[model samples]
Target: MDTRFLGIPELVEVPSVAVVVDVMRAFTVAAWAFAQGAEKIVLAESLDEALALKARHTRWMALKDGPPAPGFDAVNSPGLLRSVDLGGRTVVQKTTAGTVGALAVKDASLVLCAGFVVAEATARLLRRRAGDQVTFVVTGEDGRADEDLACAQYIARRTTESGTDAAAYLRRARESRAAAELAQGVRQGAHPDDVALCLEVDRFPFAMVATLEDPLMVLRPYAVDSLAD
Candidate 1:
């Protein structure tokens, strides 16, 4: 299978396995929610829709940013989620990147959410599914993030053995050691906290897959934790 990278702009053209990567926050938060046993995740492009879903669902699970207003959910921070009890419930999230990327690629045959925290598991899942064509839709800070590209390179290596070295790319990306570096590499600029929250790896092993039945993505939690960055 030929592997191609799809930046946010090229989302409409790709129609393979969509690996939506929002390492900075959105995707990372989704992975965490699933680890906590979230029943479903509605990926909304606007804050009002996410908030409305939450309100209707009795406090829906959500990420920040979208129509209605920006910063409505406090800008997609994991620290904020620490205090909430999401057991047996679900979330409808909006974000500046990941969620929007997922919505952008909704036409894909299978849309799988991925991030630094769940990178390894995502690779394993992709390999198992072995979708004929694989496209990585990594969202940048705004529309560009070299770090996201670098991470996409890393993920691409895991999914294929085409003599492409993902380890070196990952190492280069990690060497910067600053959240800003990843954002800048991908051309996405954000607050320092956004970078900080996105770097933590393997916090959860679950990958979210959104389906039409609930409109919200479904998460499958794996029992593994702890992976080398």
Candidate 2:
């Protein structure tokens, strides 16, 4: 198995499997939504698109980072998702890094969203599922997001049967720009709780897979052991 870690600025051939990592908060929100019983999540290119999709479907909820938008149901905080009941509902989401990376990898045979919360589960799923070459897309805009790189390297090592320390990676991620911003608790929609939740390694025992369907990219949680067939 070939494991490659690529950043947003790095251009290369897409892999058979793309694991997009955004440990600051985006994928962490998706993991929390699934834990809250959300049916699925749709990735939007922008906050506007997420709102537009939610408008057409009454029950579908829209989420984004920063200040709340016109029709957004919630802010991009995993801390808030735990209290809400998302049973049988679809969540349309847009984020600065995570969703953008996910939506860009439409050509991959399999696309999985990653954060420290679901890092182990993602590795387990890939170990059992298809794909010879795996690329971990560190979705940091500048080609080097400290948080995303840590998560991607952590997950990549696990997939390659190499030993790694979750705590060590978490320590590295804490120094990231996004983590520092959230730590201040001054960002509009972001909070210290969100950063705390995002750093919980292996918090979810499932992998969030993104499947592109033309206009919409949907992410669904797949439990690792469920694919044992």
Best by TM-score, which number? 2
lDDT of 1 by residue, 8-127 (tens): 887658476878877656776676676556666777767677777766765555566422344244345554454456787767777777777887877777887877777666666677
Evaluate all candidate structures by whole-model CA lDDT and list the values in order.
Answer: 0.63, 0.84
- RMSD to the true structure for each prediction, in A, is 5.2, 1.9
lDDT of 1 at 63: 60
**Candidate 2's residue-wise lDDT over 13-124, tens digit each?**
7678899998877899999999998999999988778878988999999999888767888888988777889999999989888888887786889999989898878988
Clash totals for all candidate models: 17, 0
Error of 2 at 186 (Å): 4.7
Candidate 1 residue runs with Cα over 4 Å from true position: 66-75, 141-143, 161-178, 181-197, 214-229
- Superposed by TM-score, candidate 2 places the C-alpha of residue 211 at a distance from the truth, in angstroms, of 0.7
Best by lDDT: 2
Work out the TM-score per prediction.
0.75, 0.93
